[model samples]
Target: MTETLADFRRRVADFLAHHGCPAGAAPSRSRRPADHVAAARVHQRALADAGLAGITWPVEVGGLGLGPEYRQAFAEESAGFETFSAVFTIGLGMCGPVLLALGTADQRSRYLPPLLRADEVWCQLFSEPGAGSDLAGLTTTAVPDDDGGWRIRGQKVWTTYAHHSDRALLLARTDPGKAKHRGITMFVLDMTAPGVTVRPLRQATGDAEFNEVFLDDVRVGPDDVVGAVDEGWRAATLMLMNERVALADNPIGSPVTLDAVVALANRTGRTTDPVVRKAVADAYVAQQQAELFARRIAGEVRVGRDPGALASIGKLAAGRLATQVSALALEVAGPDAVAWDPADPDGGLWAYGELYAPSLSIAGGTEQIQRTVLGERVLGLPREPQADRDVPFRELRRG
Candidate 1:
């Protein structure tokens, strides 16, 4: 007999209770970055061994082969724990899912098991310096070699956890003679390969959560190719959709909750202020609305239906909620929010989040990009004017 969802949730809660990482719900506590990553990997491996890592994935891929309900139970049970799984999010949530969808059977069998077990880490190499929103305009080039492999050369920016990655899901120009989107190909490249470099990028939050990756003639085998050579645009779009799901979905822990913000306000003696109280209420409603949108999208995906353009709705809404909650944290924390003394009781917790909140609108596709996508694809509005739609990428001027 199969284990039920309720039983699985209880088991997860028991495991989390015994996990020796950290205990309280405090967010201000900081640990060394390397330590956090290592701890996350170990915890992730333990989850894999327990058949709790990839809840909705196939057993062949080291998953429980259950469904979204099981996954939901695990997430709900584990949310209150002081776990560090950030390092695995891009891999298991975004890259792993996309590879499962687009990769060959050989590729899936070779990669998915190790990935699920946290034996390796992955990063997405999509955004380039000049191609942030217009990702197809990326200039990364992968040329075919006599050895039947491809030599990649380019730089990717805003790559999360790239400095700690084992492999990268890469998009490079393979046939520039074709249209911009048509000429691209997706390849899985070894991050530690010769001539590849990863540089830590400190964000406004004063943490190195992102990296700049440079690939100088990094080589990958034919088996590394995902989808057809020039059909990468399709795979890339699908990957972006998966990324939206990962970003918007509230599985695992939430970004930050309205309750936390209200509690902070109460702690700082702002709860009696009418304006502050109203802001708290408004933030709560926005969060609930976004949560509902995310749940709807996840349900659609669980039922084998594509979110298509609607994923943008979730991403945009979540981003807005994050920004709002973070701003509230700053407001409620008062002057101590920005300038914190160890003497301050709140411990300057909200400061880091306030700085980090602005990026929510920028990452995983910007708010502007999401709105444009929604307008053209979801709302049936006309696409923005493009004179180069028919022009071959080779003939177009690139800045």
Candidate 2:
């Protein structure tokens, strides 16, 4: 007795309309992060009440025990509206998946229900000052305590929404004597723990969408450990793969950016400029290509295909296309693109996109890393030589 896709879509649409979810325009001022979280909690509560929030999750954890196609349909239809549920992206995207894949039965029972209902928020605590791309080379340490728990001490940077997170899925070295990747363990750390501190990092766009977190002797019980000790790297890889796939599928674009750029070109009397027209056309083409690739990747995931290197392809294309589209938006806007004053209200959208373009190549995964992954894992290229691959983490050179 499963609901048909069309029926589920109609139910979602009707529920959204009844709740006054924004349909066309960008989310209103009430849709700020804090507000968005609150709204998402409300919406998720309704969704759970209607048995729709975790469409692809198991029924034991309050899901419908449905397939990925149902989740894909939900995402597609949800993208057509301006919903506040995006505030839970990190929770639903990275943390939830990691928990589902690696969490023990007790851990899953304790965490998944609230997560599916958006009652709690989660963030990833993985990247460190020396670790990002070479994540296995992280220096964070977790020592076992007499109380049958662990004391964690470390820093994680580029943590999205750590400032608002209720919990973090953290990675730390449990055995420095083991090889770099073999010594690590993943734990669920309470963000409200006494020594947990968060500082929002302001980006060029003037938004503190990311944060830096410092953990000082934060104690976590044995029950918090996810997967096997020293097996965090595998869990992390799975999460990163999911992250690449989800980021590639992010529906951040609007017809507005292109429309605004076109209007600006016509207003500046540059619509006839051959170079400008070509840039616009090329940008459109790139967007179409990226979208098609993303759609294909989404289809693979819907049918339960492990995307593997295909996710890298989508991520790489997304990064390149973002840069190209943003550059074209700036070109179309001409002189007006120099400043990112949203108050200007006319051409500010183009300027904002241009200003934010550089981040696309770095966020989720760097373009270089994406290409390396694609080449090695996808194309069966020779593996990169690593001096530290078999070295003990404690004996490795710090610099």
Deviation in Å, model 1, residue 347 alpha carbon: 3.1
Segments in model 2 whose C-alpha atoms lie over 4 Å from true places: 23-31, 83-86, 248-256, 266-269, 340-343
Task: Give the whole-model CA lDDT for all candidates, comma-separated.
Answer: 0.79, 0.78
For candidate 1, write residues 37-135 as lDDT tens digits.
Answer: 777788788877766778888888788888777766765576546545466668988889888888999989999998988789898899999899899
What's each prediction's TM-score?
0.90, 0.92
Off by over 4 Å in 1: 1-14, 20-31, 82-85, 251-257, 342-346
Give a tens-digit lDDT track for model 2, residues 1-399. 988889988987777676636654543322255655566667777877876777777888888888787877777777656555346667877788788888999989999999888778888899988998888988889999998799999889999878778888999999999999999999998899999999999887666778999989989998989998899999888888777555544633432355566777888899788999888888788778878988887787778777777777776776677677777777766677776566655535665566676776777768899899888988899998888988888999875
Clashes of each: 0, 0
Candidate 1 clashing pairs? none
Model 1 Cα displacement at 315 (Å)?
2.5
